[model samples]
Target: MALLLTANVAGRTNGRNVARLLQNQFPAGPRAFRVPGVDSLNHARGQPVSWLVTRTASISGQELFNNYGLKPNSELILGYGFSLPHNPDDTIVLKVGGIEGRWEIGRDAQGADGLWKVILSKFVEASDATYEDILDASGMLQEMLESLIEKLPEEDIAGNIEVRADVVEMFHHYLEGMSNLVAEKPPEARSQVKMPFFALW
Candidate 1:
């Protein structure tokens, strides 16, 4: 009984110490990496897992971007085979006129998750296509987006769609956002949409 009580007390003490260490070492706001301490006491394991927890000078994403030349989510995914789901420095590219040119979607223009509406509005304003073409393309684009959304299930399941839950959820979010934008605008405004990624070609 005495030994059990002693063991229980030691466990509680160890738990408190771990909690304190975590709290002090990882508060929040952009913890990039950690440096481990010397493993001299035991090649097995012990306390003092790591040493210094360094923080960047400024938390400004743009500042860090300028200093580090950070790449956007799209670029990172294509180049590095990984993606930041909530990447603040993300951008999208939309091709125009089949092969004439492309528009690089930036934060200032679309501000993340504004993919569908922004593309339509910008295309209408710039393209030299006729009103009928614009309308047809826009409608077609909406249908395509809706089709993709339908294919992408809301939640992940066992062999349900073969897509990650988070990926499914992310597309569902943006696609729903686009649908809401379509519903929000009037027929005349929607008719003015010009480019629908594939419809133009």
Candidate 2:
């Protein structure tokens, strides 16, 4: 099992705190590094079951939990080693509570997955891919707003339309903010990596 908490955030002290919260029990062992462009990371690839703990800012965090079908508030966990490349645009898959879902976390123009899986995973628990088969998180978010407007009662319809327009404007602002976060590099801070949980399967 592994935790992809966020991008550009690995082996932080907070990560250690979060790891302790995992529900699955595993043996204590020395922690190791498996970051991209590192030897440990390469060796772990395709090896039977290793754990990864990642931390991203809010946007990235939402994407991981939502897409994987994990509870929005539940700690994020996924099986280690992937059949698909870990590119920004690739659809990462997960099975949560025995239901499978896909999550894409970057912008459409930026060619990354959206974070709708966060809401979808929570709103629809007995999951089906059809819930997320189309519309990545970004698109789904927009559609959700439109759907909300459509469902408004006749008396409230006019006010809802005005609010929806504001939502669209605000969404663009959030997108811009996320773009900046993705582009910036981490500060020169010393972050520690903790031991990863091991599984034989």
Best by lDDT: 1
lDDT of each: 0.41, 0.32
User: All candidates: CA RMSD in angstroms?
Assistant: 15.6, 21.8
Where model 2 places Cα greater than 4 Å from the true spot, the runs are 1-114, 129-140, 143-201
lDDT by residue for model 1 (1-201), tens: 000001125445344454455566656633233212222222111222222222324343422111123556445445543444444455445443433445444443343233434445555543465666556546655564455446543433446458766555555444443333323322333445534543432
* Alpha-carbon TM-score of each model against the true structure: 0.29, 0.15
- Deviation (Å) of 20 in candidate 1: 40
| Model 2 score (lDDT) | 0.32
In candidate 1 the C-alpha lDDT for residue 131 amounts to: 68
